[model samples]
Target: MVNDKLLQNLSRNLLKILDDDEYYDITIEVGNDPYVNIFRAHKVILYYRSPYLRRILSTNKKKDDKALIHHIKLPNILPEIFQIILSGTLL
Candidate 1:
Protein backbone atom coordinates (compact mmCIF):
# COMPACT_ATOMS: atom_id res chain seq x y z
CA MET A 1 0.00 0.00 0.00
CA VAL A 2 2.78 2.39 0.75
CA ASN A 3 4.49 1.59 -2.54
CA ASP A 4 1.25 2.21 -4.39
CA LYS A 5 0.83 5.58 -2.70
CA LEU A 6 4.39 6.52 -3.56
CA LEU A 7 3.82 5.56 -7.18
CA GLN A 8 0.67 7.65 -7.28
CA ASN A 9 2.54 10.63 -5.91
CA LEU A 10 5.29 10.11 -8.44
CA SER A 11 2.74 9.98 -11.23
CA ARG A 12 1.23 13.22 -10.02
CA ASN A 13 4.61 14.90 -10.00
CA LEU A 14 5.38 13.62 -13.50
CA LEU A 15 2.04 14.90 -14.73
CA LYS A 16 2.93 18.29 -13.33
CA ILE A 17 6.15 18.16 -15.30
CA LEU A 18 4.12 17.31 -18.40
CA ASP A 19 2.09 20.44 -17.90
CA ASP A 20 5.13 22.64 -17.35
CA ASP A 21 6.10 24.94 -20.21
CA GLU A 22 9.32 26.62 -19.17
CA TYR A 23 11.57 23.57 -18.93
CA TYR A 24 10.27 21.68 -21.97
CA ASP A 25 12.85 20.63 -24.57
CA ILE A 26 10.63 19.19 -27.29
CA THR A 27 8.02 20.74 -29.56
CA ILE A 28 5.56 18.21 -30.99
CA GLU A 29 3.39 19.33 -33.87
CA VAL A 30 0.36 17.11 -34.14
CA GLY A 31 -2.15 16.74 -36.99
CA ASN A 32 -2.25 18.23 -40.50
CA ASP A 33 -1.64 21.80 -41.53
CA PRO A 34 -4.07 24.56 -40.53
CA TYR A 35 -5.39 22.31 -37.74
CA VAL A 36 -2.15 21.32 -36.12
CA ASN A 37 -1.72 21.60 -32.34
CA ILE A 38 1.66 22.15 -30.79
CA PHE A 39 2.66 20.41 -27.55
CA ARG A 40 5.68 21.12 -25.42
CA ALA A 41 7.17 18.04 -23.72
CA HIS A 42 10.27 17.02 -21.83
CA LYS A 43 12.67 14.81 -23.79
CA VAL A 44 13.95 12.94 -20.77
CA ILE A 45 10.50 11.75 -19.71
CA LEU A 46 9.55 10.79 -23.25
CA TYR A 47 12.85 9.03 -23.95
CA TYR A 48 12.66 7.01 -20.76
CA ARG A 49 8.96 6.15 -20.85
CA SER A 50 8.19 5.33 -24.48
CA PRO A 51 10.20 3.30 -26.96
CA TYR A 52 8.42 4.67 -30.05
CA LEU A 53 9.23 8.21 -29.00
CA ARG A 54 12.72 7.06 -28.19
CA ARG A 55 13.29 5.97 -31.79
CA ILE A 56 11.85 9.20 -33.16
CA LEU A 57 13.93 11.28 -30.75
CA SER A 58 17.10 9.35 -31.42
CA THR A 59 17.18 10.44 -35.06
CA ASN A 60 16.30 14.06 -34.31
CA LYS A 61 19.41 16.11 -33.70
CA LYS A 62 19.38 19.47 -31.94
CA LYS A 63 20.58 22.44 -33.96
CA ASP A 64 23.33 24.71 -32.67
CA ASP A 65 21.61 28.03 -33.32
CA LYS A 66 18.12 27.15 -32.14
CA ALA A 67 17.23 27.31 -28.43
CA LEU A 68 18.30 23.64 -28.10
CA ILE A 69 14.72 22.51 -28.58
CA HIS A 70 13.84 19.44 -30.62
CA HIS A 71 10.88 19.74 -32.99
CA ILE A 72 8.91 16.78 -34.32
CA LYS A 73 6.02 16.82 -36.77
CA LEU A 74 3.26 14.18 -36.72
CA PRO A 75 0.84 14.87 -39.52
CA ASN A 76 -0.92 11.54 -39.32
CA ILE A 77 -1.89 11.71 -35.64
CA LEU A 78 -4.91 13.74 -34.71
CA PRO A 79 -4.47 16.35 -31.99
CA GLU A 80 -7.19 14.87 -29.80
CA ILE A 81 -5.77 11.39 -30.15
CA PHE A 82 -2.33 12.65 -29.26
CA GLN A 83 -3.76 14.39 -26.22
CA ILE A 84 -5.43 11.15 -25.13
CA ILE A 85 -2.16 9.30 -25.60
CA LEU A 86 -0.30 11.85 -23.52
CA SER A 87 -2.86 11.67 -20.75
CA GLY A 88 -2.92 7.91 -20.71
CA THR A 89 0.88 7.72 -20.64
CA LEU A 90 1.26 9.16 -17.16
CA LEU A 91 -1.54 7.19 -15.59
Candidate 2:
Protein backbone atom coordinates (compact mmCIF):
# COMPACT_ATOMS: atom_id res chain seq x y z
CA MET A 1 0.00 0.00 0.00
CA VAL A 2 2.76 2.44 0.89
CA ASN A 3 4.77 1.40 -2.16
CA ASP A 4 1.86 2.18 -4.49
CA LYS A 5 1.51 5.72 -3.14
CA LEU A 6 5.22 6.30 -3.47
CA LEU A 7 5.17 5.11 -7.07
CA GLN A 8 2.18 7.29 -7.86
CA ASN A 9 3.91 10.32 -6.40
CA LEU A 10 7.01 9.58 -8.41
CA SER A 11 4.99 9.18 -11.60
CA ARG A 12 3.16 12.43 -10.97
CA ASN A 13 6.40 14.30 -10.42
CA LEU A 14 7.86 12.94 -13.66
CA LEU A 15 4.73 13.75 -15.61
CA LYS A 16 4.88 17.27 -14.17
CA ILE A 17 8.11 17.75 -16.03
CA LEU A 18 6.23 17.36 -19.29
CA ASP A 19 3.64 19.86 -18.12
CA ASP A 20 6.28 22.34 -17.03
CA ASP A 21 8.24 21.85 -20.25
CA GLU A 22 11.36 21.44 -18.17
CA TYR A 23 14.49 20.31 -20.01
CA TYR A 24 12.54 19.00 -22.98
CA ASP A 25 14.74 17.87 -25.87
CA ILE A 26 12.13 17.02 -28.47
CA THR A 27 8.92 18.41 -29.91
CA ILE A 28 6.04 16.39 -31.27
CA GLU A 29 3.51 17.89 -33.69
CA VAL A 30 0.30 15.97 -33.82
CA GLY A 31 -1.93 16.30 -36.90
CA ASN A 32 -1.67 18.62 -39.91
CA ASP A 33 -3.77 20.52 -42.47
CA PRO A 34 -6.13 22.95 -40.70
CA TYR A 35 -4.71 22.65 -37.22
CA VAL A 36 -1.92 21.02 -35.24
CA ASN A 37 -1.02 20.63 -31.57
CA ILE A 38 2.56 20.59 -30.44
CA PHE A 39 3.97 18.91 -27.33
CA ARG A 40 7.44 19.08 -25.80
CA ALA A 41 9.03 16.04 -24.15
CA HIS A 42 12.24 14.51 -22.91
CA LYS A 43 13.77 12.22 -25.55
CA VAL A 44 15.20 9.77 -23.06
CA ILE A 45 11.95 9.43 -21.15
CA LEU A 46 10.03 8.88 -24.37
CA TYR A 47 12.49 6.30 -25.73
CA TYR A 48 12.10 4.18 -22.61
CA ARG A 49 8.30 4.50 -22.53
CA SER A 50 7.46 3.51 -26.11
CA PRO A 51 9.27 1.32 -28.61
CA TYR A 52 7.44 2.93 -31.55
CA LEU A 53 8.75 6.34 -30.49
CA ARG A 54 12.22 4.92 -29.97
CA ARG A 55 12.28 3.41 -33.48
CA ILE A 56 10.89 6.53 -35.11
CA LEU A 57 13.26 8.91 -33.34
CA SER A 58 16.20 6.61 -34.09
CA THR A 59 15.44 6.51 -37.81
CA ASN A 60 14.85 10.25 -37.86
CA LYS A 61 18.05 11.09 -36.06
CA LYS A 62 20.22 13.49 -38.04
CA LYS A 63 23.99 13.69 -38.09
CA ASP A 64 25.20 17.26 -38.15
CA ASP A 65 27.81 19.45 -36.59
CA LYS A 66 25.39 22.18 -35.58
CA ALA A 67 22.62 21.87 -33.02
CA LEU A 68 19.31 20.90 -34.57
CA ILE A 69 15.84 20.69 -33.06
CA HIS A 70 14.26 17.27 -32.94
CA HIS A 71 10.79 17.70 -34.36
CA ILE A 72 8.40 14.79 -34.99
CA LYS A 73 5.22 15.36 -36.94
CA LEU A 74 2.37 12.87 -36.91
CA PRO A 75 -0.37 13.61 -39.40
CA ASN A 76 -2.51 10.63 -38.48
CA ILE A 77 -3.68 11.57 -34.97
CA LEU A 78 -6.39 14.10 -34.28
CA PRO A 79 -5.94 16.68 -31.51
CA GLU A 80 -8.47 15.00 -29.19
CA ILE A 81 -7.07 11.51 -29.75
CA PHE A 82 -3.54 12.70 -29.23
CA GLN A 83 -4.51 14.06 -25.79
CA ILE A 84 -5.75 10.60 -24.80
CA ILE A 85 -2.60 8.99 -26.20
CA LEU A 86 -0.44 11.45 -24.27
CA SER A 87 -2.37 10.73 -21.07
CA GLY A 88 -1.81 7.00 -21.45
CA THR A 89 1.90 7.45 -22.16
CA LEU A 90 2.36 9.48 -18.96
CA LEU A 91 1.46 6.51 -16.80
Candidate 3:
Protein backbone atom coordinates (compact mmCIF):
# COMPACT_ATOMS: atom_id res chain seq x y z
CA MET A 1 0.00 0.00 0.00
CA VAL A 2 1.37 3.39 -0.97
CA ASN A 3 0.83 6.33 1.29
CA ASP A 4 -0.68 9.27 -0.61
CA LYS A 5 0.80 11.91 1.67
CA LEU A 6 4.24 10.39 1.40
CA LEU A 7 3.98 10.29 -2.37
CA GLN A 8 3.01 13.92 -2.49
CA ASN A 9 5.87 14.90 -0.25
CA LEU A 10 8.35 12.89 -2.27
CA SER A 11 7.14 14.45 -5.48
CA ARG A 12 7.35 17.93 -4.05
CA ASN A 13 10.89 17.44 -2.80
CA LEU A 14 11.98 15.92 -6.10
CA LEU A 15 10.55 18.81 -8.03
CA LYS A 16 12.38 21.25 -5.81
CA ILE A 17 15.69 19.51 -6.33
CA LEU A 18 15.15 19.38 -10.07
CA ASP A 19 14.16 23.02 -10.18
CA ASP A 20 17.44 23.97 -8.56
CA ASP A 21 19.40 22.49 -11.42
CA GLU A 22 19.25 23.90 -14.93
CA TYR A 23 20.83 20.92 -16.63
CA TYR A 24 18.13 18.43 -15.68
CA ASP A 25 14.77 18.07 -17.37
CA ILE A 26 12.29 16.22 -15.23
CA THR A 27 8.97 14.54 -15.96
CA ILE A 28 6.97 12.83 -13.25
CA GLU A 29 3.96 10.56 -13.73
CA VAL A 30 1.95 8.07 -11.76
CA GLY A 31 2.01 4.56 -13.12
CA ASN A 32 -1.17 2.82 -14.25
CA ASP A 33 -1.03 0.53 -11.24
CA PRO A 34 -1.41 3.60 -8.98
CA TYR A 35 1.36 2.27 -6.79
CA VAL A 36 4.34 3.67 -8.70
CA ASN A 37 5.66 7.01 -9.78
CA ILE A 38 7.83 7.25 -12.87
CA PHE A 39 10.41 9.97 -13.15
CA ARG A 40 12.19 10.52 -16.43
CA ALA A 41 15.01 12.76 -17.54
CA HIS A 42 17.31 12.41 -20.51
CA LYS A 43 18.61 8.86 -20.72
CA VAL A 44 17.63 8.07 -17.17
CA ILE A 45 14.33 6.94 -15.68
CA LEU A 46 13.47 6.08 -12.12
CA TYR A 47 10.49 4.11 -10.93
CA TYR A 48 9.66 4.84 -7.35
CA ARG A 49 7.59 2.05 -5.86
CA SER A 50 7.37 3.63 -2.44
CA PRO A 51 9.37 5.47 0.16
CA TYR A 52 11.22 2.28 0.93
CA LEU A 53 11.95 1.02 -2.59
CA ARG A 54 12.91 2.49 -5.94
CA ARG A 55 14.32 1.28 -9.25
CA ILE A 56 16.60 3.38 -11.45
CA LEU A 57 17.47 2.75 -15.10
CA SER A 58 19.89 4.77 -17.17
CA THR A 59 21.49 4.51 -20.58
CA ASN A 60 24.66 6.12 -21.84
CA LYS A 61 26.26 5.49 -25.19
CA LYS A 62 29.62 6.79 -26.22
CA LYS A 63 30.73 5.99 -29.74
CA ASP A 64 31.56 2.27 -29.82
CA ASP A 65 30.72 1.75 -26.18
CA LYS A 66 27.64 -0.35 -25.58
CA ALA A 67 24.74 1.20 -23.76
CA LEU A 68 24.47 0.22 -20.13
CA ILE A 69 21.60 -0.23 -17.72
CA HIS A 70 22.11 0.46 -14.03
CA HIS A 71 19.91 -0.43 -11.10
CA ILE A 72 20.07 0.90 -7.54
CA LYS A 73 18.28 -0.01 -4.36
CA LEU A 74 16.74 2.80 -2.39
CA PRO A 75 15.45 1.64 0.96
CA ASN A 76 13.37 4.08 2.96
CA ILE A 77 15.44 6.88 1.52
CA LEU A 78 13.35 8.77 -0.94
CA PRO A 79 14.66 12.26 -0.26
CA GLU A 80 18.31 11.32 -0.55
CA ILE A 81 17.70 9.29 -3.67
CA PHE A 82 15.69 12.07 -5.23
CA GLN A 83 18.41 14.59 -4.53
CA ILE A 84 21.13 12.36 -5.87
CA ILE A 85 19.29 11.60 -9.09
CA LEU A 86 18.22 15.22 -9.57
CA SER A 87 21.79 16.31 -9.06
CA GLY A 88 22.86 13.99 -11.86
CA THR A 89 25.30 12.33 -9.49
CA LEU A 90 23.73 8.90 -9.58
CA LEU A 91 25.31 6.52 -12.00
Candidate 4:
Protein backbone atom coordinates (compact mmCIF):
# COMPACT_ATOMS: atom_id res chain seq x y z
CA MET A 1 0.00 0.00 0.00
CA VAL A 2 1.13 3.52 -0.71
CA ASN A 3 1.70 5.78 2.26
CA ASP A 4 -0.11 9.08 1.91
CA LYS A 5 2.55 11.13 3.64
CA LEU A 6 5.35 9.51 1.65
CA LEU A 7 3.59 10.09 -1.64
CA GLN A 8 2.85 13.69 -0.77
CA ASN A 9 6.43 14.29 0.28
CA LEU A 10 7.77 12.78 -2.92
CA SER A 11 5.42 14.89 -4.98
CA ARG A 12 6.53 17.97 -3.10
CA ASN A 13 10.15 17.20 -3.79
CA LEU A 14 9.44 16.86 -7.50
CA LEU A 15 7.58 20.17 -7.49
CA LYS A 16 10.53 21.81 -5.77
CA ILE A 17 12.66 20.64 -8.64
CA LEU A 18 10.50 22.51 -11.12
CA ASP A 19 12.09 25.46 -12.92
CA ASP A 20 15.47 24.33 -11.76
CA ASP A 21 17.55 25.25 -14.77
CA GLU A 22 20.42 22.99 -13.79
CA TYR A 23 18.44 19.76 -13.82
CA TYR A 24 15.56 20.71 -16.10
CA ASP A 25 15.07 18.86 -19.40
CA ILE A 26 12.18 20.80 -20.90
CA THR A 27 11.54 24.46 -21.61
CA ILE A 28 7.95 25.61 -21.94
CA GLU A 29 7.40 28.98 -23.55
CA VAL A 30 3.98 30.36 -22.75
CA GLY A 31 2.19 33.14 -24.56
CA ASN A 32 3.38 35.36 -27.40
CA ASP A 33 3.70 38.96 -28.50
CA PRO A 34 5.90 41.28 -26.41
CA TYR A 35 5.55 39.25 -23.25
CA VAL A 36 6.51 35.60 -23.24
CA ASN A 37 6.95 33.65 -20.05
CA ILE A 38 9.32 30.71 -20.05
CA PHE A 39 9.13 27.80 -17.66
CA ARG A 40 11.60 24.98 -17.14
CA ALA A 41 10.40 21.53 -16.14
CA HIS A 42 11.08 17.84 -16.51
CA LYS A 43 9.81 15.93 -19.54
CA VAL A 44 9.44 12.70 -17.62
CA ILE A 45 7.18 14.35 -15.06
CA LEU A 46 5.11 15.97 -17.77
CA TYR A 47 4.87 12.72 -19.71
CA TYR A 48 3.43 10.96 -16.69
CA ARG A 49 1.07 13.82 -15.88
CA SER A 50 -0.67 14.60 -19.20
CA PRO A 51 -1.30 12.44 -22.27
CA TYR A 52 -1.73 15.39 -24.62
CA LEU A 53 1.63 16.73 -23.49
CA ARG A 54 3.10 13.30 -23.96
CA ARG A 55 1.96 13.23 -27.58
CA ILE A 56 3.07 16.78 -28.25
CA LEU A 57 6.47 16.41 -26.60
CA SER A 58 7.00 13.08 -28.32
CA THR A 59 6.49 14.65 -31.74
CA ASN A 60 9.02 17.39 -31.04
CA LYS A 61 12.32 16.52 -32.70
CA LYS A 62 14.44 18.53 -30.30
CA LYS A 63 13.72 16.19 -27.38
CA ASP A 64 14.72 13.15 -29.42
CA ASP A 65 17.98 14.81 -30.30
CA LYS A 66 18.83 14.92 -26.57
CA ALA A 67 19.63 18.56 -26.61
CA LEU A 68 20.53 20.42 -23.43
CA ILE A 69 17.01 21.83 -23.31
CA HIS A 70 13.84 20.55 -24.99
CA HIS A 71 11.50 23.26 -26.24
CA ILE A 72 7.71 23.57 -26.33
CA LYS A 73 5.63 26.54 -27.42
CA LEU A 74 2.19 27.45 -26.05
CA PRO A 75 1.32 30.58 -27.90
CA ASN A 76 -2.30 30.65 -26.80
CA ILE A 77 -1.85 30.28 -23.05
CA LEU A 78 -1.29 33.15 -20.68
CA PRO A 79 1.44 33.08 -18.05
CA GLU A 80 -1.13 33.19 -15.28
CA ILE A 81 -2.92 30.10 -16.61
CA PHE A 82 0.38 28.33 -17.07
CA GLN A 83 1.31 29.22 -13.50
CA ILE A 84 -1.79 27.39 -12.31
CA ILE A 85 -0.66 24.37 -14.28
CA LEU A 86 2.81 24.48 -12.79
CA SER A 87 1.51 24.94 -9.26
CA GLY A 88 -1.26 22.38 -9.62
CA THR A 89 1.14 19.66 -10.72
CA LEU A 90 1.32 16.79 -8.25
CA LEU A 91 -0.83 18.68 -5.77
Candidate number of the best lDDT: 1
The count of residue-pair clashes in candidate 3 stands at 1
TM-score computed on alpha carbons, candidate 1: 0.73
User: Candidate 4 overall Cα lDDT vs. reference?
Assistant: 0.78
Clashing residue pairs in candidate 1 are none
Please write out the lDDT profile of model 3 over residues 5-47, one tens digit for every residue: 9999998877675444344444444324424444444333233
Off-target runs (Cα >4 Å) in candidate 1 are 1-6, 61-67, 89-91
lDDT tens digits by residue: candidate 4, 1-91: 9999999999888768764678888889989988798888888877777777789877775534757777889889887777776766332
Q: Is candidate 1 or candidate 3 better by TM-score?
A: 1
What are the clashing pairs of model 3?
52-76
Residue pairs clashing in model 4 are: none
List the candidate numbers ranked by lDDT, top first.
1, 4, 2, 3
Query: How does each model score on lDDT?
Result: 0.80, 0.74, 0.44, 0.78
Better of 3 and 4 by TM-score: 4
TM-score of each candidate?
A: 0.73, 0.68, 0.27, 0.73
Q: Which of 2 and 4 is ahead in lDDT?
A: 4
Q: What are the clash counts of all predictions, listed in order?
A: 0, 0, 1, 0
Least accurate stretch of 10 residues (summed lDDT) in model 4? 82-91
Clashes of 1: 0
